[model samples]
Target: MTTKTGDQESPLASQVDPQTSVSRVPPPETPAAVQTRFRVIAAFWAVIIFLGFPIWWKTTSIYRASLPLEEMVHWADGKTCRPVFPLEIHLSTPSLPYIEAQHLLRTTQHTLDDLNEFAAHHLRLKLANDTTGDHTGQDSSEHVNYAARETPDTALTVRLLPQEGLASPRSELHAATTQLDVFYPPSQIPVSSSSNSPLSTFIAAELQQLYGEEKATIAHILSGDTARLASTSPQLAEDISRRLRRSMKYAETYHLSFSLFTPGAEPSSWDIEAAVNEYVSPLLQALSPISNFTVDTQVQLYANFAPTAPKPEYDESEAVWTLKKEGLSAFVNAAEWPLNPSIGTGPTINFILYVPDPSQSPLVVKENSASSWIVPQWGGVFLLNPPLSNDEQGSRSNPAHLSLGSLGPAFMTFSHQLLTLLGTPSTPASLPLRLQTSIRIRAATLLLSASSTMGSLARLTESLPSIPIPATVATSVSTTLSHLTATCSHLREGRFGAALASARVAETEAERSFFEKSMVGQVYFPDEHKVAVYLPLLGPIGVPLVVGLLRELKRIAAKRKAKAS
Candidate 1:
């Protein structure tokens, strides 16, 4: 019974012990299995290292094209090109012999060179081919037709004619043409032997005076040295600076939006088409050679000023409403008024014709008592004080409709202000001359502006190394530089129109390159942000592969050591 009981306990104990026993250590891994595990890790790492990384790098890499950074900076610093104005003046000596005319030209050129303080802007005298007759009293139509065929480089035509009763030589500038008529006594004409002549000296002096302002202006622009313009009148320097400050930047086209704004409900409509045709069209036509303009007009009623704007106060002495000169800056209620820029390319110039309520019928600037004032780099404003009419309620009100005749003065003022806004010079009185001067000024301004843009773009690329430069931006930069070179060449050859065209293209391209959307967006995306984005996937995958590679390497080293021992 004891033996049977012990055997039963032993079986139970064996079963219980087996159930509670720790697991036995597994046999050493097979060489084939270890080799297989190593191959798995190697294959996994091979796919990631050789295939995945290459694809990621190819897909995520930023393409940065090469740029001419040093050249761009040189252009901005005025080292690549120095602007020069070589004005060609045609000398027409109808009354003098050809030899004498040639002599006169030589002497006059010598005198001009001596008198000129600015070398870049100097006059060059050339004998006119058609010097057959006196052009002083020529028919206006004939002169105009002749002028149309003349070379665009010809800045002026000097007609030297012998006048009987003149003791001293006198000169007259044609108002409608670029011709100068110099009336001198026949005795003043220099002989072939004479090295110097009074007539040549006089001509040189007149030409010097004629171009004094332009010379000073160009010098100021090129050098920014006021001392170059020391010979110029103080008024001229002031005018140049003022014009530069007030002028709008150069553009190929400008949108002219004429809006009639009023504080009352009356004067809701005006003959804008007729008024523009009568007053503004001619000036725009004249300015067509230099710039293009698109005209649009609208009428806004019950357009009140901003509450923050200074209201016009009634002046007891002047018997009219007056706006303080200092307060004129806040006159335009930009927030409330519909002064949105025109929907098109180029800049929009808003000309506001404001008609006050009947209570403040006649409003003017307080200081000068002028009815019009210009907003610099923007537009102009004119206060229209229409004659008050008695309504059904016996209350004075502005007329419901303004006729073309009533809008004449206001339009005239607008035209004048338009010239001022377009950077038209006040001197030389001739419209054609002023326009020509404007061409040179505009060309210089555009060239400088484009160069500055190039420099800015170069610096931007240099400062932000991670920003991707698109092929489009590189193409634009190339285009801009090429056009800039063309512009410089044209300017040197005195082809003002071509220079202006080329400069316009350069400016456009430079602006496009500098403002490239792709380049701009990439600027905000940094490398650290990219790393943060990729860390989660790379961390787990990378750590295991690295550890497996190290363990395999260690095993191979141990096997070699064991074999050596």
Candidate 2:
């Protein structure tokens, strides 16, 4: 009953009882087995460090290219290009003797030099060939080519005509050509002995007056303040500021889209081809030397006003539908109207010829009671209220097709708006002269714009250290710098047209570099996303490797202690 006193058991029973039998212990590890485990662990770490880690790094890393950051910043700071405009004015003395003409030129040059305070924009008077003839009364075609060939950058030509009827010198600027006519009384002519004469003084005064605004504008743009560079009247400064604010940015090309918009079904077609040919083609041709233009036209029906737009109301005093002057900005139903910009590298100018519904007939701006107005850099808007159709119901509807004659006035306004939007100066009655002035203005504007853009890009890179800059951005920056340098050189050499072309390239490249899609896309990857993607794989693999490394280290330390004992 006592089970033979627990210790007194048979050999077989003792063997069956696991506690009394010898315990099964694992054998000590062989040197080869320990070496094999060590090799396996080392292999795992080697694969991680040399292969897996490198692959992950290559896949996840961003690509950045070297850039000339200092150079770009310098260009933006206006430290690189100090723009100088040495305008060359040709003096044509058809009536004066050679020595007398030279004497007048000397005296006038001295007077002009004395009057000019802006050294960068001073006029350089040069004598024109006598054979070019008096271009004052003649057509521009008669002398433009000859003058262009002889003197490449002649801003204006002064034709001296001695008249018996004139008591004092009277100057006239041609409306089409770059010629200025000075009809002088014979007595006002400068004698060889006289250092200064009335004619020279008059010419100097007229020249100053003609270029006064231009000088102010250039100075304002260069110095960023007219008050700092020269003494500019408040009125002139205000006008310049207004014009600059209203003008469009400089571009290599401009798309002119003339659209006929109507809320109703009528006025579905227009003689836009003929209208453009007659009114806009010549101006575009004249502007071809500075920039290219693409002309297109369309007629859109059922184009209603936006929901938030101000509706025209009947004016009691004028007995017409009138829109408030303040609300004119929202007159164009941009949401409903198909005023998409023309597809091109340059900007698209939209000229909307809106035909109001019969209910809002004779719609005009309330304050001025005008039918047309310029929308700053956008375009122009004109309200055309066509006469009602003669029907049994007497429905008020616009004509299906607008004739060229009917479209003339609207197109004329559009042309003038186009000129203003292109940053053409209002002064100087000559069209060619205005175009030249526009060229200079555009050049100056583009140069400053590109410089500013470069500065902005440099600052952007410095501010956002995590944003990856691509090789294309570096390439674009280089191209911009090179073209900007070329533009400055061209301006210095009086090649304004060439300068504009180069500046266009520089601006395009600069904008492209600054707005690169890839660079922008790289900046938005969040830290949460990175952790979610990497933690699962790294956690499992790292724990085992670290534990194995620690166990091996502990074993080696114990072995060294045993050896030391």
What is the alpha-carbon lDDT for the whole of candidate 2? 0.86
CA lDDT of 276 in candidate 1? 94
Q: What's the true lDDT of residue 29 in model 2? A: 96
Candidate 1 to truth, TM: 0.89
Model 2, runs deviating above 4 Å: 1-27, 130-152, 191-194, 229-231, 262-269, 300-321, 341-346, 355-362, 385-401, 526-532, 550-565
Report the number of the highest-lDDT candidate.
Answer: 1
Q: Indicate the worst ten consecutive residues by lDDT in candidate 1.
A: 1-10
- Candidate number achieving the greatest TM-score relative to the actual structure: 1
Cα error, candidate 1, residue 368 (Å): 1.5
**Which stretches of model 1 miss by more than 4 angstroms?**
1-26, 130-152, 389-395
lDDT of 1 by residue, 1-565 (tens): 2223633554445546564476766799999999899899889988988999899999999999899999999999889988777888999987777878888899999999989888778888999874454668779998887665444488889998899989889999998889999999999988888888888999999998887777777877777754655688777788888887898887789999999999889899999999999899988998887789998888888999889989889999989899999999999999988887655888999899999989987888999999999999999999989899897999898999999989999899999889989988776867778788888878888888899999999999999999999888889999999999988987887778778889989999999999988888887889889999999968987898899899999999999999999
TM-score of 2: 0.84
Query: Where is the poorest 10-residue window by lDDT in model 2?
Result: 1-10
What is the RMSD, in Å, between candidate 1 and the native fold over all Cα? Answer: 5.8
